[model samples]
Target: MSDPHATSPEDVDLSRFDAIVDVRPQAQTRPHLPESTFTPLERLLEDPAASLPSTSARVLVVCDIGMRSAIAARELAELGYQSVTSLDGGIDAWRRHGLPLAGTDSLTPNELERFDRQIKIPDIGSTGQSKLRSASVTVIGAGGLGSPVISYLAGAGIGTLRIVDPDVVELSNLQRQPIYALSDLGRPKVAAAADSVAATTTQTATEIVQGSFDSSSAADLIEGSTVVVDATDSFQARYDLSDATRKAEVPLVTGAVYRWEGQITTLVPNGACYRCIFPSPPESAARLDCALVGAVGPVVGTIGTLQATEVIRISAGLAPAYAGRLLMYDGAVGTFSSVSVQARPDCVCQRP
Candidate 1:
């Protein structure tokens, strides 16, 4: 076995092995092996459970290094396996490298390959990506917050992106709103931002609403949408979005950044809508706008990226990430804080 290629698949250490149970013909990955011990998830993904023995069984995953087996062992536990052990030394280090072992497989459909990168996540897989294609999302505001939100959602292949922004970008907005170049300063942000989304590979379709989200028209804007992002910069609009999204029964990803500080929260269906968190709108403060306080690029960027992440997660059939929680950041101190939130019992959004 000393030849260059023949010297491969060496022996592995078993000192750190959690437990090694060969299930090729035996049993035990979880504490109570079902009539058959094969993972139900695997059954649903590939072959049927009828292919496995009905007595009991466990599986061993062999990798170049035992490290991956160790990691996969943990993965099985998280998937409801009470007892999953790994080979301390990997396949390369195994004494009986040729030992019989049952192997698992993957699903690699042609369409799924386009989203190969996304399907790798546990929270989001090919199944989740499919849900995203069937989901609709509405984003309010097309400035700083909407920039990254639209960009990522588009890049993530969200099925539909609906943007409603009645404002135009001003010359002064180039500081943080990079979606609009200096060349299009006076153009409506909705059009410019919509164009940005239209260029992404994952973006399938987009709709731009050139109007503010008011009481009368909010219903149409919220119709059939899975979620809404409140990236607007006005207190009235934020509150309006909060109220409207609540009635629409869609999760709301709200973002706010001032100077070097930023905060994000999932509202409406996730928790008490924003009104519960901010009981009464802080007395109107005309002087505290991002324009007045001066927001840094990264601050708004941070908030916007999180807003998009929340939107995609919810659309993709994952639980609302920020449900009952708020994430606040202080750039100066680099401190982050999260607090719990509850829905107001008597809020007017009892129906959506």
Candidate 2:
């Protein structure tokens, strides 16, 4: 007989379940069934409304053992999920039964081998990787933050990458933009960034748009992207992208870096926006740009890496950490902190 608390692998029909929601801690290593969606237990416990999708489709919850899965099943049930079940014995029982399992879904032989390690992640299974492969991300600026953002996103298998930048690679750019080499000097930054994206993974296709990000073109550039990344140093560019993205109702991941400090945050359509925190630009003379204030390569790299990480999480259909929070990194002190934010009542972004 099946256990009263959970259903055994033999009793659970995978074909009947529309989706499997893994609620284990990410540190635990377990081979995930193909097409499974990962939502860490803590995330679900803290905010199930945001972490979980609003689906009526039947979902099976699983973990290393049945304990966490049972908890997740109960949480879903309490949330009014019509049909929620726990996989008895979790993945361990499933594997012990010699049942059919797929590490990833819709992956070609080469892709399967290429992303083998990533495919093993319970939350990012084949479906998540497929999402990554089908996503198109546009990154504005190919400078400090853009370099690592472009490189890592491409390496993560972002299928379509559109690099937009009006500047040309310079000898000084080599310090922070390692994606370019000495030979790239004098060449358009978009060209070098596109080339770097191509070299990272054969699965990713690259596009180059040579233009500065401004009010007029920001909307057009961000229109069709799966995600828009703001990697520019200018406040004007950041404000322009923020306004355009908010108006477009598209997700925006913006990053900024000073000499030893950097900040990153994601602005979803209905959530807090960049303007909520800073309604107006800093005083004219008080503004600082990387060119004038200078920056350490690693500081920008840290912020860029975080930006890329958020992009991947967004692509994977996972909630981003910075959605309602601003993450600040202090390279000089080696510390990271975050502050919560909300949409201001009178903010223009609140308008429908």
Candidate 3:
């Protein structure tokens, strides 16, 4: 019942705690409790949906001298953690009580230990993780590009993922769409993708739209998204989603892959819209889908992964890579390149 943030060192007790979290910067924490875990304040702030112990568990947050730990505990309380507190004097107070110090590390004990590496990245840290937890992203398609995009986004803990695809999983899709299994062949792509995302992380809420994405349904499917990703193979769907997002002043991350080649770009409200680059749709005779063109698995993966990265970056308040540029990936030669894009004066996207 004691407030860890307010308890004095003389009255401190560790046995009452279910877990002790050290939130100090790793550099400043040379000696920490042997049993305590280290997760910096920024990391905790970034990961809005961190999978901590059960709400019933007693968690005591600690920092170098208690300032940040108190802040973190308050944040956890606001997030509805049932029992949370901060160490008053932090590690310094613990040492004063002659407690054994542990190494500098902070992560909850969970099966998803694989995320430790990325959680330590300065830019993404815990804060970025939290942002991903709060973000809602809608990916249009569950095919090759959608496969990687969905996998990465789901794995990264995107709070809500809306998958829209009218097609069903097919035998031919196994080569690149790793999110589906042989048994999923007859299932709708959105259903299969939802199952895949659920299996990846329970933190992400998967929304399925088992039909085509178009102007008619765009508002319902994508209007609330923090970012829209175009992974659909058809140009019509891409243009539809792009136009809808453009009108809503939302950002869209889109990519395309064809025969060992792929391209990625971000269409922001104020920047050049997708139509600015094309002016008009390609002729029916010239239009090509993967069915007619053929593409390698890695090509789609590369572009899809890039699209996912852009979504993550944008959600985390970081600069998007292809806002006014097109990133081209040549899988045959294993090279990546980019070209600047400008808003067409005559295009509707140029209007205020």
Residue pairs in clash, model 2: 38-123, 105-126
lDDT of 3: 0.79
Rank candidates, lDDT, best first.
2, 3, 1
Top candidate (TM-score): 2
lDDT (Cα) of model 1 = 0.67
Would you estimate the TM-scores of all the predictions?
0.69, 0.73, 0.70
User: What shift in Å separates residue 239 of candidate 1 from its native position after superposition?
Assistant: 1.6
> All models: lDDT?
0.67, 0.83, 0.79
Per-prediction tally of clashes: 8, 2, 18
For 166-193, candidate 2 gives per-residue lDDT tens digits of: 9999998898888999989999999888
lDDT of 3 by residue, 1-352 (tens): 6554356656657788888777877623244555677677898777734636766778877776878988888788787777777778876777667565554233233412445455555566555666777899999988999998899988877889988889998998998888999999898989888988888787789888888888899888887889999998888777788899988878999898878889999999888887888777767523339888788887788899999989989987778989999988888888989999988898886766
RMSD of each: 9.6, 8.7, 11.4
**Location of the lowest summed lDDT over 10 successive residues in candidate 2:** 25-34
Tell how far residue 115 is off in model 2, in angstroms.
1.3
Model 2 ranges with Cα > 4 A deviation: 1-103, 284-287
TM-score-based ranking: 2, 3, 1
